[model samples]
Target chain A: MSQFVMPSLGADMEDGTLVEQLVAPGDPVQRGDVIAAVETQKGAIEIEAFEDGFLDRWLVPLGAKVPVGTPLAMIRTGDPPATPDIPQPKDPAVPPPPPETPQPAEPDLPPAVPEDPPLAPEPPAPPPEKMGTSHRQRVTPAARRRAAQTGFDLSALGGDRVISLDDVPSAPTADAPKPLSAMRQAIAAAMARSKREIPHYYLSDTIDLTAAEAFIASRNADLPPDARLLIAVLFIRATARAAQSFPEFNGYFEEEHFSPSAAAHVGMAINLRGGGLVAPALLDANEGNLETLMMRLRDLVMRVRKGRFKARELAEPTITVTSLGDRGVAGITGVIFPPQVAIVGIGTPGWQPMVIDGQLVARRVANITLAADHRVSDGHRGARFLRSIIDHLQQPEAL
Target chain B: MNDKDIRALMIRQLGQIAPDVPFDTVDPDADLRDEFDIDSMDFLTLITALGKELGLSMPETDYDQMRSFVGLQRYLSSHVT
Candidate 1:
């Protein structure tokens, strides 16, 4: 049997009313099928089944309020719970999603739960090793089979602990991506501060990327895999070089004063492998040539993803660049990260009809947007800075 | 290597990028991005890994040709000795 819980959609949500049940008992439901709708603080959110099963029974009736994780219904999966018998597609060019449970481990501090300690004597309990050899002997052959069937590594139970049938974990669900609660809070705080403090002005331009695309293709043709540049490298390079001439958009704002840095330390936003976003600085972003810049970007991306980013690299960004070209978004208007006066957003590049020298032809184009602190620089300055970035992208050989 | 060996190696390398995906059920002709929702970085990372494994280079210009499982295997078969 499996559970369909009352899922908490927001951080502050405590409980929700089951306004309606979309599926009745005995209904065969597929994964991702919306089975119920709950009324929370954020209005009605339709909850979906996480596993393929039939609804066996409803634990909570309609109009009942329940807290998050309170199972609303029981589901009959009708088979031995799926173990990690993952079939790797023999000829797959497309890989299967990683067979990993996305849920974070419980916030358990330690295994030091005190079990009826006598305060007067304070004598430590008998060590597991001293009383312990019996614990190993008590392991049933059937329990070992249960552990193996569930793909729970038996060695994980450890030599110190007693093994029991109850200790075997059920099949892990890799269906959902982990919710990054801690990272989400940190992002919320920063963005909230940005909105509260910075008076922002936004500017956008549709720039043709034919020249840049051709340049990257030509350059990457002969380079090794490690040395090759992704299109993001160009976005970073262009933003950094453009910030060189426009000092207003390229510096820190602190203590009611705007101090423009001589060098542009562009913060390139990278989405991590599992989930979450990090924008670490590429030190001396404007000074390096494209080859050197690509090398730095590669190193920074690799290091940040591995959670090995240096303190200085994480903190030294003067301006930020977020490129969403690959995800297929047209444009994004970013809120300026506090203390940084400007952020550049690069949207997806698409083939658009453009007239070049009186001939209408298809060319690669992207929407570049500038969101700057209006307290330091107005729309005129922001527009000019965006224009300069577009100009730099025009001549990739020069940039 | 035989086709079986090549497929096994490809799945293993892809496993590194998408640690939670079920690779065995993916259609060989499906796009990795569409199948597993891998972004550009993951795609590039996969290419880098494939290059390292096969001792070859796949230029950005040729990424589209290697978009599917069958396509990647073909690319490796032709490029690898």
Candidate 2:
């Protein structure tokens, strides 16, 4: 028999929650078959089978929290072990069984004394003003310390009703700690490593969106309710096309070598309302048509907002894009997600005067910044990639 | 049932779930969630995998009690008997 253990999804993760079990005991599983779902710091991932065999035993139950490498279940390849008779151990050197006790004889005159015992009745105890007065209330240690530090009376705050300190705001202590949610911790580790390890080089370009906006307006007039394209969809499509032009930017860097990939898996940095971020991918952005890209982008954003994005959605991005359109930020530079060579940051569209064939005219322009790994991509290549995206935006009909 | 066998099985199982994870350096005491970012679904899959490998009956409710390596070891030890 072989045990299947919990897998560490990333470099920084230590533990994971077992969110769901896809397979049960006695099920035949093969290699790469998804057996269960795990919630990592990154996101929920499907745990795949390692060996082909019958699922013999489950070491841990579903929804159990487990450390890295903890045996989650087992598979039996050989013949099943025969059932062994586990002996119930007897107490060693046991004393002889206790002698049977003899019963006492009742007196024959007991009938004469039974009539005098019912003369007095006992008094009942009085009920207290409040119930559960002696019950201990649950409160954290921090709350206890806060109540001690401040003159605030916890008893008075909750009244004489078996007061609980939960409602009382705990004073922050030096050791006041809360477990980091699986997502937040993962984000912290990834961001910290990206800042520390990856050498980021940023390049910014202002693209005239005059044609793109007009093209969008024209398309929207005839588009279906769900097929209407947003500026983000246009940015993604144009970036995907630009990635094709600059193949070097659409790949990963590993072992000091740049591996250019054919697929343009575009990841979008989505800002969650409470201030965390998740970058779910629009896989194969170049393969889909305009309507498909629009629907996919919309779906990805909705999933991201609801925190229901799957692990595959966040992994294997060849390139990433982040936009601050709703924030009204004109332009901002960003760091690249490591392994992936480049990330494009999109800014809010603004009206700016531009020289159109030597004559000054008001035009809507969007600022796009590309941050690339300097070890893999040089300044010239990065600039050209940014320029190509701008060119695509300028001629929107071509995208 | 031996310790070495169990460790080897663990390494093999971990590799299957995370193909890129370096098994040789994995610390047993590390919280898989905090240290490696293993999520709930992955943990469940791991349990299912282990159940198939070890021939032990583990129910869903048992997962709630088995949060750490020691917890898992105790759970297996009890049930394997």
Estimate the Cα RMSD of every predicted model relative to the unseen true structure: 24.3, 24.9
Q: Candidate 2 on A245-333: residue-level lDDT in tens? A: 89989987878799997989898887664457777778889886787887787667656655565544565678989887633479878
Q: Rate the local accuracy (lDDT) of all candidates.
A: 0.73, 0.67
Across B1-81, the per-residue lDDT of candidate 1 in tens digits comes to 777778888899878767778887677788877666677767777888878877888887678888888898888887788
The regions of model 2 sitting more than 4 angstroms off are: A1-15, A25-35, A42-60, A65-182, B1-81
lDDT, model 2 = 0.67
TM-score of chain B of each: 0.88, 0.69
Worst 10-residue stretch by lDDT in candidate 1 chain A? Answer: A104-113
Which predicted model would earn the best TM-score? Answer: 1
- Give TM-score values for chain A, per-prediction: 0.55, 0.67
Residue A281 in candidate 1, Cα distance off native in Å: 0.7
Query: How well is each residue in A1-399 modelled by candidate 1, as lDDT tens digits?
Result: 888777644323456667778886677888878788775432355677878978876777677666777888888787532542334224343234334433322232122223432222221232355553545434455556555444455666665655778876644222222333544544555677788999988899998999998988888899877777777877888888889899999888989999998988898877776556777789888776887887788777766666555434555688999888576689988878777899999898998999989999999999999999988999987888999999989998887
For DockQ, the strongest prediction is 1
